[model samples]
Target: MDLGCNRSGKPKLTATIRRADSIKKGCPFMLKGRFDRVGNFWKLQVVNETHNHEPFVFKEGHAYLRRMFDEEVDMVARLHMGGLKTQRIVSLLCKWFPGACVIDKDIYNLIEKLKKEIIVGDTPMQVHVFEFDLL
Candidate 1:
């Protein structure tokens, strides 16, 4: 289990109820919970009660995985490629989305993932590549 921060700057916590030792077992049982400031307590909710797919052993870079739309990712990628720092990008995003709040690390992770995708040929960059890539 790992404790983290959510997009809204609230505490985001997750726990693995059951671990899958084999691919035949499918996905591991996991639960995502959050802290409610108003109630001053933690709420444990089962986001995925069952696993239909195999779980990765090495979960590195998985922290950046969230429920974001493709358009949002594209917009963040564009901003990241535009030479905006992670902090500035986060501020802009928060402003554009009043109810939305983002942390620096998440933005950094998103930008890093975008850069890796571009390098690995998984995704194409819309911005021009200068001598020093603004990553």
Candidate 2:
């Protein structure tokens, strides 16, 4: 796992080290909290990792997933020439995906990713937007 520094200045590795027992009991695959030292006392932050709490790789994974979904959404949007109802579009995708799961959060993430890319208006946006629109 990537044990990089977090926004609160506590590195992920330190959290893992401190809360290894709790995580082992709960979900070893999760990095859900942090360890803080205030003078001579140490405190364990048992907060679950929210979307914003996620580290670099988590964000990258979401970005990659968002790109994939955006491509699909863009294709559908162009096919119908407008925005689509949430359920109708999801139903269409589900037909092809079968057991695959696409939730509201996934759609929101994709939209956010697309908007950010559009706002950036960089070379990546040019390539990805064209590809998405075409497909």
* Candidate with best lDDT: 1
lDDT of 1 by residue, 3-72 (tens): 3222213232445687533223324455677889999998887755654544455433344343346766
Candidates' TM-scores?
A: 0.43, 0.34
| lDDT score of residue 23 within candidate 1 | 24
- Name the lDDT value of residue 81 in candidate 1: 74
The number of clashing residue pairs in model 1 is: 0
Full-model lDDT for every candidate: 0.60, 0.49
Give me the runs in candidate 2 sitting further than 4 Å from their true place: 1-81, 121-135
- Consecutive 10-residue window with the lowest summed lDDT within model 2: 21-30
Query: Compared with the true structure, what per-residue lDDT tens digits does model 2 show for residues 1-135?
Result: 223223433234544535632111222222433345455554444344433343355443332333444457674445333566656656666676554456555655655665566557568758687657644
Candidate 1 global lDDT: 0.60
